[model samples]
Target: MSLLDDDAFPDMDSVSRDRVAPYIIRTEKRKAIDANGKPLFRPRRTQMAQVAWETRHHLQQLLYEAVTDYVREGYTTRPCARRNATSVF
Candidate 1:
């Protein structure tokens, strides 16, 4: 089953709906727990954002290092259409 019901979010665009659907499900679960007198531990938005930024940054760094290594090994002059192509990320 989909996390988000299309009928409930008919006006939302696909990308935005996808991003928010999980959060909506989490909030509903938290509310259910709260009704049962259980403590809810929601993460701060800043912390989540920081983690995403760090992950993206690390991936970019790795891509840069790979490209640099390929170039340093005298592969820059070769055409990129080969089976073992070196792509710049």
Candidate 2:
């Protein structure tokens, strides 16, 4: 029967005031690895990878500049990738 149906309610004539208790509860779950501060795993994001790629490209360009200008043509340097390409050699 529905709670709204008066017939479902404990009879007021027989039920005592102390007998009713519709209390509420709240909770937060802790995993097995729950620690004082650190999380078990780091969240995923794109900005970190973008920063790393920028650093790598900048370093590659600087090394290319140094090798082409300051070094001799016969001298061998670690090959760097060209634009839209995978490998230099």
Candidate 3:
């Protein structure tokens, strides 16, 4: 059974559509839930855009972390390709 056939897909109170590729999964602040103690209604139209932006930010942070880690610990190992995807020798 396809999820589309289900009512949940069409009538999702909160949903992220596929048009928002590379930003489908929402991870950014699209709606201000608490604005001066008021509930905020998030817009489905702009949710994708916000999520995309947040995804980019997260990727950058991860890249930085990876590079920093490599720089700090790279010298411990000799530069060479691994054999059989395990041993460097």
Candidate 4:
């Protein structure tokens, strides 16, 4: 079964979610643990949004790296493409 299936990872905690594209499995960060040994996540005030933005940027970087690697491997013939690829970051 695919990860998109609800039961594919039935044991996953409620804090995690499956991504559609790139199929990333994201997990929540634990800020600390109490005496009971349960995970205590950071306050969500704006943390969730910040995390989402960071994830997006990370994916973009991955894509950029992949493209650069493809170009570096001589798969593309255009000189401008090579210049543009490395200029991304």
TM-score-best of 3 and 4: 3
RMSD of each: 14.6, 26.7, 18.0, 16.3
lDDT of candidate 2 over 1-89, digit per residue (tens): 12434554445332323333232233333332345765555555556443334665988878877778755543334243222122211
By TM-score: ranked, best first: 3, 1, 4, 2
Clash number for model 1? Answer: 0
What lDDT does each candidate get? 0.53, 0.43, 0.48, 0.55
Clashes of 3: 0
Candidate 3 similarity to native, TM-score: 0.24
| TM-scores for all predictions | 0.23, 0.18, 0.24, 0.23
Q: Residue by residue across 1-89, what tens digits does model 4's lDDT show?
A: 24456654454232132333235555547546778977777565643443334765988878878889976775655776655444321
lDDT of 3 by residue, 1-89 (tens): 12534443454322333322433445456555674855476566634443334665988878877888886777345344222123311
Q: Tell me which of candidates 2 and 3 scores higher on TM-score.
A: 3
Full-model lDDT, candidate 4: 0.55
Candidate 3 clash pair list: none
Error of 4 at 69 (Å): 0.2
Backbone clash count for every predicted candidate, in the order shown: 0, 0, 0, 0
lDDT of 4 at 44: 59
The residue ranges of model 3 lying beyond 4 angstroms of the native Cα positions read: 1-56, 79-89
